[model samples]
Target: MSLSIRNQIAGTVTDVATGGAMGSVKVSVEGGELTAAITKDAVEALGLASGTSVVALIKSTEISLAAA
Candidate 1:
């Protein structure tokens, strides 16, 4: 598939938690893990599960910075 998003991270799904109409997906990446919130319907539609290999696509319009 073609996408305009470039910040993609390849990882393996570690867990999927669904509640109500929302869902949380955890994926193991190179040095750490990442979690994404998605719709429960999307969780099933994409067939996401543990050990599933997928790419995490990120497209954010805002950036936050804090003084160190």
Candidate 2:
């Protein structure tokens, strides 16, 4: 698939938490883990689960970084 988003990270799904009408998906990226909140329907359509390999497409206008 072709996407305009340039921040695509290949990773493995670490966890999936679904409740209400939203779902939180965690992907283990190169440096750390990336969590995305998406609709439950989208989650089901993607068939996301732990250990599933996927590409995380990140498209944002602003990003905040913190020192840990």
Q: Which tens-of-lDDT digit does each residue in 1-68 have in candidate 1? A: 78877678999999999999999999999999999899999999999999999899987543355797
Q: CA shift at 21, candidate 1, in angstroms?
A: 0.3
lDDT digits (tens) for residues 6-67 of candidate 2: 77889999999999899999999999999989999988999999999998887765456779
- Candidate 2 residue spans exceeding 4 A from truth: 60-62, 65-68
RMSD of each: 1.7, 2.1
Q: What CA RMSD would candidate 1 show?
A: 1.7
Q: Kindly give the stretch of ten consecutive residues in candidate 2 with the minimal lDDT sum.
A: 57-66
Q: Output the TM-score of candidate 2.
A: 0.84
What does the lDDT read for residue 49 in candidate 2? 97
TM-score for all predictions? 0.85, 0.84
